[model samples]
Target: MLFVAAMLAARPGLSQQASLEEKWRALFAQTSPAAAEEHIDAVLAACGDSPAALRKLFACDSAYPQLGGGLHRRATTVVDGETRYDVEYVVRVPGGYSPVRSCALLLAAHGQGGSGASITAMMQRGLGAEVEKYIIVAPTLPGPRRYAGAAYQEQAYLKPLAWARLNLNVDDDRIYVSGHSLGGHCTWHLATMFPHLFAAAVPMAGVPLFEGSPYTSNSYLENLANLPVWAIWGELDQKGPGTLSNVHFCRMAAERLRQLGNSKFEGTELPGVGHAGWWPKPEAYARYLTSHKRLAAPEKLVHFFHRARHGRAYYVEAIRLARDELDFSRRPQPKLRVQPGESLAEAAIRTGKQVYDKSLFKIWADLDKGANAMSIRASGVSAVRVYATEGMFDLSRPVTLRFAGRSWTGGISASARCMLTHYAATRDATAVICNEVDVDSAGKVLVRFGPSGGGETAE
Candidate 1:
């Protein structure tokens, strides 16, 4: 509450801006998603009518609350079968931490049978003195085996990261995720599904491909095009019956990345090293993690996804994909292997239905904000939402969108609806969008506007 009071006292001048600030405070103060969304309506109402003004207001980054430094154990609420429970996580705030200086965040997930406390302790040991440059967060990932999937994404990762952003001075561009073994698998999952949220990913001794339900990392290789991946594993880990070894998967990933035109991936295989590979020393680890920063608004983006929920890469999102079951989940089928004497085409024809790539969706988008023009190439995707922020382009100019050989060139007005709705959904004020343009596969253009404005369409 004192932090809220400080924010109120810091800005005293105009009543309008002050009113919006109060609304923001009220919005962030809500603990639950439903409450937060309900509060967004009030915030939108307080913004009057201008989308540009709303963008400016929301662009004001909130100051980090005065939270003393230390390892703090926090709990986030989660729901299951109409019942709710609390999930615990550990956050390591560097000694002598100050709200004035922004620091990198490291999401250290633990392996099977390990808890958040153990992972946090391991990070403290590994990072040593260099840990002072980061705020390390370790969540006791949910599920009996502490699996890394959609549930972990929401409860363990997203919730904790949201808390850190609101309460700590976290550098959005310097965030990193790393894990070992099962945690390493989680690291790969997080990096593949949410590359936009991380600058780099370090996965030690874990392969994304494992026999399991809900598929593995093979289908999402293109998503790693821009994210720097440092995959380290023992050459002898998990090599046996029903296993293809971590080194094998890492090598395959490197090859796939190359095929995807990605040169940002690196795979290091240690001789004789087993499942528990190794971690870089404190100084080296810090230097590697801090050397890279996330590209907030890349001019070009490539993303491939099996589920539409993970379709967001950066400025482009596949809001509506061509797939019937966007949230499909099932045990993965065996790959269509080419028989000893069968031709590759023959093998595909025989078991092509078991192939993963055939069912995937992809979107390639290039933005030329200077010309106010953007082009998109999509496959198995029905519709996309393109976000426009002041950081990406000048919203004051006419924006042109081209898809499927059709082009629409018109001025796009910032919409309060788009701004508020996006903020409510993401809770990320750093990349809050001013406006969004929704386009369909057939070249239909829908520029979303708030209550004060009307929808505009172009062929």
Candidate 2:
């Protein structure tokens, strides 16, 4: 009897029960569908009948089918603060799609006032045979707002991507993003804001928004230095005054990419075409998209954002923004002085009134294992704060930061309580690690550690 019981306990599926319980605990701690989906299959197979609460925990009744490729309309409930939204998305799978084989995924964003159904129909018409080769996902935007702001990127684009990754056998190296018109603007924004998520980007008849301007500036274009960006625009397309022509903007963005030493950037201007011309040429877009694959780990990354919510780039995560408001003059500059034996609580009270101008940024690498140093440069910014982690450098060994004929060498360290406090306030998990330093008056800030370990971690 004992031998028989041991055999049953040693079964492959039964052994996963404990892991399932641990995953459920983590899932409930952060109420996200993506987290739940990570271990859903294993949990369902291992303890589906044993735990009555497991079904309720994941709302498993609403789970969609994972097999048989076709058009699938799925709705997910997303909660932000006190409000809950029933977000719906359309996923079209090729007839040949198989659970055993991974397929390329394309996230298609619709134009203003358009639904996922409409964009899927457009793709069906335009892509023809190419549509069957990839899994396409289109998400509906909430209300009448177009893909004009960060809200659309967060709710519409990112939510659908997360859903597809969880539900489908998506090729992580082949994931791509594309959009037309207003969606095109969002494509640029998403590509820059989260470059690591995409292998390539296609922005057609759209302009990137930057600093209250319709078109992306040269300074902001540096964020896409490591991305393979292909932009398309109609030569005859025009917006109101103070806005540059879409064709001109694409050309300028491509030139900026080239100036930054990116060789994969390309811009195409369609002559004798209007705002809606690119819709019929999905073959061209497909060819470009298929030629590129995502670089899972890159040697260097650069990202800049005005808000803490948009802080993540490829390998670096922004813990805090330079200032909440774009105007630097309005930001409070705190004066620091130690009077005759002031209490710590009093110093904290005084500092709390002042603006925390010290923005924090962190990079994950195992530099101690190799000998190659990472180089970085930024313009049109006051100062940059950088932290190296994941054993990127020997904390005890001296690391040098050189810029503008000046250099600073020191062992980097930060208070764990300070990092945790900032994360508690901003809800940014990436800021919890330590080893931080700040570079003042940044022009070209170079960090000479050692070679990289070539391992990848989240930004």
Candidate 3:
């Protein structure tokens, strides 16, 4: 067609990328899983380890004529240390797409035992009219696995996002994430672990805080205080005897957000509907998602971590957690019960013993009062950084950092240096100003001091 020819001619040197993408799709479609994986390995072997080469091989740009609309199969290599393998994903580019203008991107995760193709089809129908306005991406897990675990999140979700940022005309401010059932749980994990990356999120019929799950005690709900979240559930959607019901999880999450003063969180309970109701009414979820945009930085941030698996959130970076904090987080809380005549004070004391020291290494920062300050009762934390002028701190003024019974002072020069280091690690162009400081590893680190006349030094 003339349209296809014009598109190919407009983007020079795109033919090879298009060819590779087509071959990958054909191979995936025609061959058995084992044969397809073998062919993928061979194709990726030819591309080598060069970032530029890999990008081109994956068709990271909008050069493929078939990508303008409908589902398109693409392959990319996910490198985990020395090991590397090719993975497949499906992307649906809205009709009438233009390279000059960036459009919203919806990262949809499929349910258990589902592939990118099936998920993409479901989303197209579920999202209804909203599908016409955005680009939808669905990633298939390797092999025949249904559950999305930590490995899949890194390989399928995060890697694809990095690729999309480089290749597609994506509006960074409008990137959204959503999922159903098992995918919904993955949605919660992804959104909470990396709240800064998403504008909004919708998790349907999934419970991230069920007993025996790794996320049970390590619910990073506070990290999502600034992100808009819409959680959906059915009253009768309990999957099994030991499983936590979606309704209970969503209600508890909503209540927790409310207690934290987060106004952007909402929980929608579908009456008389079961776990599968959300797929039939995609427009309902779309309504909550379309108008929201990501705030690259917020004035206040709270982040909790169980381990070093996740280190950064918005403007706050956790260098490390104290040994005691990690230990306490892992320890089970005592179940307290009040006697028949027990006073409220007595009950409080019993409960406090179990949960009082839970936040020993928690991080909290606030800049609404027009000063750069933070607080952390952390012991053995090597370093922590409070980004300046990323809407979290005022770099023009002096900073007063107080922690572990010590006070540190720094000026604009120190803030600038810290900002540069943060920019280097994250490569986030939006962060104009940021700062970092090493904490005393012996005791608590609390930012509760006055300004210093020096340029940049912790004294």
Candidate 4:
């Protein structure tokens, strides 16, 4: 009789959980960021505002389809500008895949003339015995061989990763990305833009956009300071007669990596290898990929970005960039006429100002939980957001932030809304924070909350 009564009492709780799960499904389905934020706020209002309670409610796992582990080709919708189309990707699940045991996930991309199947086969060949332990997903480029664009990045690369996280028992800490040739270029860009998503990156024979027509000479190589990067290229690889050799770019990246104190990065220039049809030892590559795990909360983060969408790394997010610093139109035109005594090289330097400085945003931050304080240095950005967890800040006491020759000390209140906001954006539970504070360059708090019932903001 008592057991029966207990079951009856638990019925309402079970129903509530199911309802919350349904809401979470819908929340993740929302495409627009603003729409997602609205949904999150609504859910917080309907549910309680306690982050612990909400996190527990949102932690429930869903049922997976019974597709007995193997290579499965799946089609996801891709939208590029006005056109929306279906693109296929290949996912290889080990035969031993089980929901009970989490497995590492490898997101690989293919170069031009290569399909998803080809990259899967390539990884399988490269991984050899190690392949069986990983769930590999390879997405073909939707149209051109460019992974730099939105369609390829959002739909082709990240969507499949989201799908795997939702459906499979993926170990978030062990996720890695790798590619070859054009895919290698994609790997470099993805690693630079989304360093938070992977444990390490293996970019094979790809060029980092340093000295190019489209991109300026300045590089975002500092962003890779925390990410473990293994870039391999042939010493003999050259793009064309007038273009610089692949080795030159690789050496430049290596130099930058050294300057940034990135011991994890390795740029390999094989003696006789060329741009195509060759790779370093597969076993060695596999060893490097499996060696590192994702750092959920790093003590420091050095991030640089050209686009607002790619402004976040670790706990620091650039909300608004300084327009005057990033606007090419505001820059003075290059000197067309050279002085009579000036050399040709001097004239070239005067007239040639090829850089993406106008759009670049720089953020450097160090979190000291022991001191309950954070120190930040920012450039080319007017506003920034700091998402703080227990690992980053002591929520119970007043948190101090020193930035731009000013210090702001305030008590940080934990909120479910803040947690859900990040969770909704990342879909990664590790990124969910206990509290968040937005401040402009002058260290004025723009928006910050205090206790659940005391949300505060400043104009």
Best by lDDT: 1
lDDT of 1 by residue, 219-240 (tens): 6777787888988888778741
Specify the highest-TM-score model's number.
1
Query: lDDT per model, in order?
Result: 0.71, 0.57, 0.59, 0.71
Question: Residue by residue across 149-267, what tens digits does model 3's lDDT show?
Answer: 44444567777765565455677778898888877777787887788889999887875532224224235677788898887778777652122456655665677678878888887
On TM-score, the stronger of 1 and 2 is 1
State the weakest 10-residue window (summed lDDT) of model 1.
208-217
Can you give the TM-score per candidate against the true fold?
0.83, 0.62, 0.68, 0.81
Arrange candidates by TM-score, descending: 1, 4, 3, 2
As for lDDT, the candidate ahead, 3 or 4, is 4
Note the residue pairs that clash in candidate 3: 388-434, 402-446, 402-447, 402-448, 403-445, 403-446, 404-444, 404-445
Which lDDT value does model 3 have at 394?
57
Residue range 90-115, candidate 2, lDDT tens digits: 99988998644567888887877778
What is the Cα-based TM-score of model 1? 0.83
**Per-residue lDDT of model 4, residues 1-459, tens digit only:** 222222223233544344444555566556533247667766575455667665554344232344468899988976767887667899999998875566899999787689889999999999988888899989887865554435345567888787777667677788999998778777877787789889999988776642221233226778887889999888887741113455655665687688878887888888887888786677897899889998867888888766677788877788877774444334345556777986554344334433354356788998888889988888887778887864577677888887766788877777777677756554455555777788886657844556644556642
lDDT of 2 at 179: 81
Instruction: Please identify which of the two predictions, 2 or 3, would achieve the higher TM-score against the true structure.
Output: 3
